[model samples]
Target: MTPPDQPPPLEPAELSAYFALIEVSSLLRHTIEQQLREAGDLSYVQFQLLATLGDAADGSRRMTELADGVVYSRSGLTYQVGLLEQAGLVARAPSAEDDRGVTVTVTEAGRDVLARVFPGHIEVLRELFLEPLSGADVRTLDRVLGVVRDHMRAVPPRSARSRRKGAARRRPAVDDA
Candidate 1:
C-alpha cells in the first residue's frame, strides 16, 4: 500500500468516499435486482445481458464484447446463452466476416419475453425511483453519472497480473471454463 504522505496515493477519506459511493449504488441496485428476480424471473446480470443485446442494431453482440460489458465470463456467458437457447429466448450464429467470432442474437421469443416484462419494469422504476425526482434532479444525475461513466471507461483494463491479484484478494471463484 502506498503511504499517506505520497502525493500519488489518495487519502483514506477519499478511499472511504469511493466505497460509500459503491455501497449506495449497490443498495439501489439491490432493489432493482430483487424486483426483477421476483417479478420477471431474471437475475440483474441476466437482465443487463438481455437488455444489452436487445438494444443492439441486429440484436446481436459478439461473445467477447458481451463478456467484457456484463458480469459474466466468456464461458459463463456461453452457458447462459445455452440456457437461453434451450428456452428459445436467443440464438447463436457465426459472424459472417469472421467464423471464429460468434454472436448471440435475441430470438423472436426473446422479443416477446422482453415485450411482456419491459413495460412493467419501467413502471416499477418510475414508482420506486424516477417519479420522486424533480426534473432538475434528473438532469443533474444524468450529467454527473455521464461524466463518471466516461471517466471510469478511460481507465484501461488491468494487466493479467493485476487482475489475478485483485481477483485472488476478493476470493471470487470465477469459473472461466
Candidate 2:
C-alpha cells in the first residue's frame, strides 16, 4: 500500500521516459554550453539571444518580446542585454513609436560571432542530436515537442508575463547587411 501523504509513483514506462528526457536535456545543454563557450565566449543565454535576434526578419526585437521569447525575467534580460551591449554584440535604443519602450538589435560584431560559431554549433547538433534520429523519428519528435510546448505556454509559470513596466520596446537596429 502507498503512504497516505505521498502520491503514487510513476509507472515503469513513464519513469523511463521521464528520466530519459531529463538526462538528454541536461547532457545536450551541457555539451552545447561547452561548445558555445569555447567558440564564442558566450553563455547559453547569450547564445540564445544572439540566435533569436539573428532569426528575426529585422534582426531585432522589443525588450519585452525578447524576455518572453527567451523565457527570462525582464530584469535578467536587461542584465544580459547590458552584457551584450558591452561586448558590442548588440545595441539598445528607445522606440520611436513608444518612448517608453526599447528595442534591441544585433551588431556587425554579433553577426561575425554567429558566423564563426554556427558551423561548429551545427556540427555538434548534428552529431549529438540529429544523427541518431531517423527522418521519421525527427518528425515525431518535433510534433510531440510542439504539442507539449503549446500546452505549457497555455498554463502558468511558462505563461507568466513579466511585471516590468514600459517594456513595450520598438524597431530593430539598422540592418548590418
Candidate 3:
C-alpha cells in the first residue's frame, strides 16, 4: 500500500486569519496607547488597570480580583501596578482582611486624565472600530467573537505535565517546596 499524501508544513501564509488577528490587535493596542500617551501619558495596560479599578465599586479592587478582571496575570498586574503607583495614576492600599493583599484605586488625577482623553477616545472608537459597522453588524460581530472566545476557552490548553502528583483544581499554584 502507498503512504497517504502528506500535508505541507504550516507557514505564515497558511495562518492568514490568526496572523491577521494578532497583527491587527497589536496595531490597535499601539494606536490606542499612542493616543493615550499623547493625551494623558498612559500606557495601554496602565490605562486599562485604571479603567478596571475605576469601574469597580468604591473605586477599588483587590490585586487578585483586578488581575482576574483583566488579561494580566498576578505578577504582571504587580509589575504594572508598581509603575502606575509610582506615576500617581493608581494607588495601592492594603486589603481589609488580607494584609498580604492590596487594593488598587484610581486617583483624582487619574480620573482627570481619563476625563480629558475620553472624548477623543470615544471618537476614535467611533471612527475606527464602531462607526464603520452597522448596529446589526456590531451585534453580530460581538456574538461571533463571543462564540470564538468561548470555543477557545472551552478547549483544554496543552502543557507539559508537572511533577506535582494531584488532581488539578481551578488554577495551578506554584509549589514553593
Question: Could you tell me the lDDT of residue 169 within candidate 2?
Answer: 34
Clashing residue pairs in candidate 3 (N, C-alpha, C atoms within 3 angstroms):
none
Best by TM-score: 2
lDDT of 2 by residue, 44-115 (tens): 889999999999998889887787777786778899999999999999999766788899999999999999
- In candidate 3, where is summed lDDT lowest over 10 consecutive residues? 168-177
Among all windows of ten consecutive residues in candidate 1, which has the lowest summed lDDT? 168-177
Better of 2 and 3 by lDDT: 2
Model 1 over residues 1-177: C-alpha lDDT tens digits?
667887787789989978977896786688877777666577676777788889999899987678766636667788888877888888988987678988889888887777766877787678766887899998998998899877754543221224654453332333232
Give candidate 2 regions above 4 Å deviation. 1-8, 156-177
Q: Name model 1 segments beyond 4 Å from true.
A: 1-20, 156-177
How many steric clashes between backbone atoms does each model show? 0, 1, 0
Write the number of the candidate with greater TM-score, choosing between 1 and 2. 2
RMSD of each: 5.2, 7.6, 5.9
lDDT score, candidate 1: 0.73
State how far residue 64 of model 2 sits from its true place (Å): 1.1
lDDT by candidate, in order shown: 0.73, 0.84, 0.74
